[model samples]
Target: MAKVKSLDDLKKIKEEFLSKEELQKNGDKSLGIVQIKVAMATCGIASGAKKTMDYLINELDNRAIDAVVTQTGCMGYCYAEPTIEVTLPGKEPVVFGYVDEKRAGDIIEKYIQGGELVGDVIPVNYETIEEHNIE
Candidate 1:
């Protein structure tokens, strides 16, 4: 193998591998705003998780929303197959369940863009922890 002669050659190679154009074109910045994650569990995948993922990617690309989409393992909510997680800047992450392509669109539109909570919220376990007992 040919050794890199100098810093300039290494830089050129690095530029090619991590090119701005390529990053913008293929990196996880297409959404340009939020980050999306779909739980591709066995049940989720069986229930068409990939389709939902594609819908989100296409929708974001079509609308030119800057965001990144990733896949995760079982979210432990198997009953709610095809679950999704949305992480907005400066906000707590939200997990949605029983999501399909249509619901995916709704999520993108309502939560991601409109900032309105959509339907089908995964019921959370709220335990009241008494901070201090009054005398």
Candidate 2:
């Protein structure tokens, strides 16, 4: 990490640390807002997931959208390295692949804001433990 030279730099560092902590803690579910989990594994970073994540974070805040964006490990989709899983409150999580900045913007406008499904959706093939238990 770089040394903080000024109060502004220190504040930036603090905010970054807090954001990373929030990512690790998985954000606050009680807020009931849109939750975005970006795949940040090795392959994901190579595929530009970091850019997508930064874009999502900035755009969401700029648009004043209530969303929690977090970094996560591999989603087992190396072919779709820059993938993201979006979960709207009271809805099932949807995983989107090949998510560059433009695609991410579309996802924010169409899916997150308008509740309309966009392209590049990677279907959930496996059952979750909760789903299995419920069945």
Candidate 3:
């Protein structure tokens, strides 16, 4: 990567990096697939989330899976550290913990490709504001 010479250059680089997200956001034909979000907070980085993220992105691409991989902030499961949330189209999202390289591959090969759960899933015990009305 070349050094950014100005704000325009930086913006161009950012756009390149987020091209996949842009496609998903615009609903430009890549919809109805999988959405993957990797926890990338400080704690997550310390626990090797970056590697897990890279593994997922590369593996998914190599396997020709239509998915958008994004990075997100802390999920409040510090004990879980490197975690990922995968949401299949028309289905509830599922979070998995301790996502090392091997586990990431398993997730891709099994959960993402075969539609079977095959990792340490972090159960969702609460509903989001979007899921239900709150008084």
What do the candidate models score in CA lDDT, each in turn? Answer: 0.81, 0.88, 0.87
Tell me which residue pairs clash in candidate 3: none
Candidate 3 residues 10-123, lDDT tens each?
999889868755455455334766899999999999999999999998999998898879999999889887999998766678999989999999999898878899878999
For model 3, where is the 10-residue window of minimal lDDT? Answer: 21-30
Candidate 2: tens digits of C-alpha lDDT, residues 1-135? 788899999999889988765553454444457879999999999999999999999999999988879899999999876999998866778999999999999999999889999979999899877788743
lDDT (C-alpha) at residue 104 in model 3: 95
Tens digits of per-residue lDDT for model 1 on 1-135? Answer: 578999999998889866653444444533224768899877889989999999999999998887779999987888888899887754557889889988998998899888899968786565345744555
After TM-score superposition, the amount by which residue 34's alpha carbon in candidate 3 deviates from its true location, in angstroms, is: 1.2
Model 3 RMSD vs true structure: 6.5
**Candidate 1: where is the Cα deviation over 4 Å?**
1-32, 124-135
Model 2, global lDDT: 0.88
